[model samples]
Target: MSFFKSLFSKKQPTARPKLNHPSELQLNDIFTFGDSFALPEAMRKQQLQVVDINTLEFQHQHYAQIVGQGSGQQLVYVSFPNNPKKLIKLSLLLSRNEVEALFDLDAFSEIFEEPGNARLRPLTKQHIYADMIADEYIQEEFMISGYSHQQDYRGTQPPQYTEDQHGREFEYHCLEGGAGERSVDIFIFENGDTDVYLSFLRPANEITELWMKGE
Candidate 1:
């Protein structure tokens, strides 16, 4: 980690800008990590926030805390209850004012893709403090029909069928829930650094499979 000691320097954190997705704008060299490939930054901003839900009133709330490092540096962790996998961690490189700017609704716009062919989009600096607030929980899913329709694949060997001889073996990774539209895909952004990835549904989006994908 490098430090800027000059009295007048450009290292200062400033007001945030609107947020946007990658392939939606131009960026320097930021990257978003994904399963298939990494993407490039399509937008830029000073901070990011969590809004929509409140910590005091909501059962499923997001909590934030700042931890001090022995080296005199600090890191902030913003965690969500609805999505256990979602957490925004930040470092001392950015000032509290910059962090505050991130929470502003007007700070960010546009999207930035990660470096390779990865399909998931990573979070950006535009994800300021205000974006950290919790407003609501929108339930969503993807629906796909399975081949066997059996509840479990226990005691069964890996189903393999030749496409030419008999038939092709296919599995369904479906979505379930009420009569509303569901989210077919999930984008996971890890670390404060713009790292991103995609989450694929398997065996009807089993919880077991979802956990394994991250590791």
Candidate 2:
């Protein structure tokens, strides 16, 4: 990874800014990884102390050692039960704080993510980082379902559908989840993404008519 040595320099480890999401945080804004601002709303209510800091000579990188105890909503996939915190490399900026870190979304995921739990579904990388998608429909659906009843059929996993008649097969690659109010069905086709319920939740023949008309 390229270093931004000119942007930030190391500062006192005791100094840090509280942040929720760093979307609006300017490039110059600085904070330590252990600060409560770097934590999720629920995780912040509990103790997330910075116990140690270590560095690697090979990569010329420093990482923070954190320990979090107590309990609250499990927003992250990883659990912190007397959880020996994950060590993540701090980015190098030209500021006066070499120890200071930016706990942005990617950094935040690394801390909460467990080893070897990645790559469950290669097609769903965004879901892995809890990242956002631009399609508003799928976004809203994910908000409702929260990965529950999730279905994946991309990469090596082919669509499970047995129906002989079908349009563009990419529509078959989907993530269907939940039911009732907490429900979402998204199809990531070659051309674009669309809600399954919107595009294909009708009689096969009726779907054919609409699909042909759209084509």
Candidate 3:
């Protein structure tokens, strides 16, 4: 939490200047797209506050925290209630090879054929990382939507997908919300591996209020 606090605390002036070209605006530059803005400090803070392992709740039930570690990598996910129309997806990727191996598994095939079975696998590292990475379609959607590019493709970057130790990196994205809209907030953590969390339906503002009320 402290790490995130520091990461979001570094702020530039809020003033927006006219850009000569969209390319001049770096992905990290806080910019507006439709109803969404790049994850700003306030939004990031709200997300961190509500999504903490200590605060998460869904459907009047507390979430279970599950952790997985192996092959010099680690992954963590907190289980929450599911929405019928939209679901929050979490994935942990240890290596590029592991991701490739996913395509050949029977269980992976079943996930596509029966989507309702997607859930946090048991804490065993092999079981968790292999079964939980974002489904291929979601990965493709993220990439095509430009969110992946904004994060420098950190979620799919091969260097961070290796077994070698490296400093951790974090990336965030916020999609718009409201009536007939399915908003998603994505968080990616990269170390020797990558852990991705996608939040749908429950936007940061609602989550923050829910946490505050102990709901």
Using TM-score as the measure, which candidate wins? 3
Instruction: Compose the digit string of candidate 1's lDDT tens values, residues 12-42.
Output: 6663343332211112212222322111121
- The C-alpha stretches of model 2 lying farther than 4 A from their native spots are 1-42, 70-215
How high is the lDDT of residue 104 in model 3?
A: 44
Model 1 scores what on Cα lDDT?
0.23
Residue-wise C-alpha lDDT for candidate 3, range 65-160, written one tens digit per residue: 322222233332323334464332232323535434434444323332322232222223243332222223222122111111112221133223
Structure candidate 3, residue pairs in collision: none
- The sequence of per-residue lDDT tens digits that candidate 2 reaches over residues 10-29 is 65566334433311122222
From the highest lDDT down, the ranking of the candidates is: 3, 1, 2
Compared with the true structure, model 3 gives a TM-score of 0.22
Question: What local distance difference test score does each model get?
Answer: 0.23, 0.23, 0.29
Lowest lDDT 10-residue stretch of candidate 2: 205-214
How far is 90's C-alpha from truth in model 3 (Å)?
1.8
